[model samples]
Target: MVTERLSMRNMTKTYGTNTVVKNVNFSVLPGEVHALVGENGAGKSTLLNMLSGVTMATSGEIFVDGEKAVITKPTDARDYGIAMIHQELQNIPELTVFQNMFLGNPKTKGGVFVDKDREAKRAKEILFELDPDIDPWEKIKNLKVSQQQIVEIARALLANAKIIAMDEPTSSLTPQEFDRLAQLISDLAKKGVSVIYVSHKMDELFRVCDRATVMRDGQYIDCVNMKDMTEESIVTMMVGRKIEKVSHHSYVTDRVMLEVENLGRVGTVKPASFKVHAGEVLGISGLVGSGRTELFRLIFGLDKPGLAVAKHTRMSREIAGLDKPANGKVIVKGESIKLNDVHEAIRHGIGLVPEDRKLEGILKSRSININMGMPSMSKYTKGGFIKRGFLRKKSYEIMKGLNLRPLDVDRAIGTLSGGNQQKVIIGRWLASGTEIFLFDEPTRGIDVGAKSEIYDAIEELAKQGKAILVISSEMPEIIRISDRVMVMRDGEIVAQLEGEDINEATIGQYSIGQAKKQTEAVL
Candidate 1:
């Protein structure tokens, strides 16, 4: 019979007046890959933080191998054979790979001096077990995101952790790297190392996890074996409602809102062109490093294009510039928008919901009202001063429309969940009367229920005749919302599909550089 490796009974955590987690029960058996899933602010993080000793639980009982354990600090958790790998990587950039692997537990000589050679040999041996190509002597800062994640995993293993908890470990990893990591987790499970996998990606969870424990609104919803769980059922349990199928409303219009000719960046986006119509959703799909993001960056003026001519039908003017100039031309409503200026982009009714929302989208220290109102401040201004009353009122209105929780305009935007933070970013532009929306991996780290809500918002924008362009790695998202799907491979737009042509199999073919067959028909 399998033994329980770890268990939490009646786990509860509260912050001031808010109860973040309540009466949550979770367990993991030896040699099991267990998933902890929930929407943002659903208490998943709070519970994990408590278990890892990053935060103290207001009330709970933790057991290790059937023996009650006391964990008041991170070291205590480590002492009990628990180690956590966070979503954001935790490694010093200046340190070497081997150095980071044996960070806290360093090798010493004669009781005092550091023994670098011995540690390096051991770190090399361990890293080779995961990836034979990684150099132990390489600096952590110079390694790819995937290699850095491997280093973190190696650290946990070096600590001899009996149970490893990972939080969105593959969020930044490539598909190939993710597959490798999945195999590594499976091997660890086979060796009797229990894993608590936390992720928002349904495909990854289903592919790697044996059992799933779900939470909602700070309460335990259910825990079930993977054989009995479907994506719909799991999502339903998360949000307490049946998530309706995403139906795309026919929004193709004759009037093209934006048009581009010869858009390209040498060594990045290849020479490509596309047109977006009013009330249309144009989805861009590709593998990592396929230039989907690079193409969008060129259009938004964040990156200079090698050769491009962009014209907006409503703008009534075209702006042409030199190859690899400081800014690309972006015409909006008859006026040529300054491509290099972010503020100018906003003024022209263009907004980018960037890939990294936490870093590029929202301000952490500012209040919700400030973060939401800043983009549309001109609307709430009187003479050069912001009208505080109008700002608060308008902010409240936008928050209500998005159903942002707490409804407190004065709360720090950083205090919100991944989903709510994204809402605030999109809300900023929506409040500003944005017309052209560019979403770069909008649902990257958000959960299923929040993804459904974001999809609804995007559809509403398209229905309102706003030109929408979405770049996503998730095939299902691209297929579901796009009226036209453009597949990018090796920095070029290889194929474009509409209506009946857009499907997973077709996209997969184009993505793997096998677009010759479909390109003739579509291009």
Candidate 2:
């Protein structure tokens, strides 16, 4: 058996009253790919953070090669031959690939004078040694997400990492790029490097990992070899119960509230067409970067489609006579108007819950009330004057309805945790009185306990006659909440499943181009 290179026994992490990860015990053996997986907010990120020295384990012991090693910080872990690749890109976007590769550790030509030429040469050699496709002198900001991932792996190898923890590395990678990465991981295993891979995708785990560890709600459940398990069994273990198999949700709406006849963006979401009725949830389920988010952005006026994938036709306006070639009009109710304008969209009762909540959802400097009540300021303020009392009073009402912890209107929103911050943003739109809501990865970065609350709120909104369009990577969420599922691949809406067809395996098959409209499903 390969010897254990790193061990975390009785690992736990806590913030305030919530325990993010608890009593987790695992080992990474040399020359093996150990996949760590669970649902979103099931403590995978916290566990990886503990191992990577980004966060010190609250109460645990870490052993390196059978010796107790101190890893109170990131530098200490690097000293012990441990490295990590974050889920969110960590490289400096302004810096070149070479500069980022040798950021902290640079070659000195004359004791103090830095040798940039030699540093770039060494960086190129490292990248070539691994992938050879990524150029070291190119600016990191100019590269796609896949190329950035390759650069990160090359840097880890250059540091001579014995234990590497990767958090959802393939989330942004294309199929061909993923295949190359899987092979590279195998090659690294052959060289005796232990790889700890974290992901929620089941197919990738079965293909790439030697053994797997399953965690649920911050607790470690089991660690078993890949050969001994199936996807259903692993999911059952991780979730602690069998998820009831449900077909698609049946919708009873005939009122076409939002119509997209030919909606599209060039090289992004194709000319896509779909109709959503009031009180219905339309789910677009696909892998990351499958243009699920891109499609919704166009509908909400966040971006104008360069090309139309689908166009809408109404009784009043001619679809062919539309000025925009990229796509036709996004019609609300009976009138057809251009959806490519920001002010027009919100005025027409449309609200968007963005994917990156930290960057886009809530304002950092604003108060909780301001974050929640800013959507429709006219309702709370007087004519060309301040109306502070009404704003705070209204914001508190929405926060209470959402079950936010403190319901403190005066508190700065940035001080709250991720879950509470998400509530603030949701509450913001809920106050807007929008008829159509587009939510992209609505429950990301929040804890498991909060996810249930968020889902309940979404269900409430749908039941209240809102046309909801949801884009989520997690298949289970799509199945549990959506009234209809639209499977996308390569920026095209390949299949639309109504009642009795939305299964996780079926969605995966469609998203990967494995199963099509004509082909029978393997599962």
Candidate 3:
């Protein structure tokens, strides 16, 4: 019998009355890239945690090179040649790239002084292997998310780990960075390093993985060779049933719901122009620094643009100074108004689901009920008294509608998973009765089943006459949900596509600046 590099048999983890991972049997051969996939709460993370010694398994037999092993803590896992890069970047932002890479394990000379020069040289070598352009002396805080991810990969390699497990590592990466990562994984496999890759991106999994293990409701389903399995079959094993692809018929109307003309920030964004109808989903696709988020910030009134003009379909009152057209004009219904701030924009029936959810969407310490109710408190207020009962009732309804698990409104939102936290943020906006929704990376860091649910929710809102805008880095996401797609590159909108033109190839062509422009570009 051939000995596996890493193997687990009947691995089970339970907390109180709940079993998060149930008798999961998995293994990986040397030089193989194995994918671990499942819906949210399907035990993928839990299984990985056990292998990495972040959490102990209740019952299991772990083997390394045909020998039984014990992994009781992180140090034990490291000693056993195991390493993990979590979904979130975990690094000291103030430290330089080289400093962060060698922070815990420093090179020493003669077992006395630290070998700073040797450490820096080694760090540079590892960094160059991942991305030759990255500066080793640059601070982690200054690096983009994609750059930081590469740094994490370098750190794992510096540890000389035989097995590395990566969780959603490409969630924040650009197309170029992802390509580099794919090549890196291929090279690592050639070096006899086993990789356990976890990602919700189907295209990426099929491209890189040789085999995949699917889990559902905390139990192992089946492991299939990539050559023999299709995306549909893998998804079926994950969800235990079939989920139809989300399709949207164009709901565009001649009546403009939101319009921006000449909205430009001096050094940041250029003169951007676009219009959304009462029920259309306008998808914005771009590279990392393409100013898609910046344009959205200007429209949402989070950033002051040097030149701006915006219009909405609903407003509380007619905005002043529409005749001057100083920063552009925002017209709702038939009256022009100025959305100079977020409150003003919200008051005019516009809502923004910010890209950084934890920073801008929810308060981690607050209860789910409070987080959901805080945005629309006026509805539950009477004179000087706050209606706690009404607020609780509304929060409950929102939870039920969004299918939030555990259903405990009193629990802190921080205790929930990534997908559940997103639902709370979306539910908060729904409670406010906003007519126009702007979602930034709505399915980012979320699982496949949850992604489907969010897609359905977005389409349902469009069907109900609510205009929606989506900014996504994933090409599949842009093609699946967008009725019309606008591709941005280097702070400018280079191409716009609609109908059958919104496939991966067309989006890729435009995103990489290959599409010829017919008119002046806008960012």
Better of 1 and 3 by TM-score: 1
How big is the positional error of residue 415 in model 2, measured in Å on the Cα after superposition? Answer: 7.0
Local error of candidate 2 at 136, Å?
A: 2.1
Q: Write one digit per residue (lDDT tens) for candidate 1, span 93-154.
A: 99999899878788999979878898889988888888877888899999989889988888
Model 1: residue 509 alpha-carbon error in angstroms: 2.3
Assess each prediction's global lDDT (C-alpha) against the native. Answer: 0.85, 0.80, 0.83
Per-residue lDDT of model 2, residues 90-123, tens digit only: 8999989988887777788887987889988888
Q: Show model 2 residue runs off by greater than 4 Å.
A: 11-24, 37-47, 56-59, 212-247, 261-274, 285-294, 304-327, 337-340, 364-370, 380-427, 442-463, 472-523
Candidate 3 C-alpha lDDT tens digits along 111-196: 88888788878989988877888888888999888788888878888988889999988988887888878999999999999999
Candidate with maximal lDDT: 1
lDDT score, candidate 2, position 268: 75
Please provide TM-scores, in order, for all candidate models, with all chains considered together: 0.92, 0.76, 0.91
CA error at residue 70 for candidate 3, angstroms: 1.9
Would you list the rank order by lDDT, best first? 1, 3, 2
Better candidate number, 2 or 3, judged by lDDT: 3
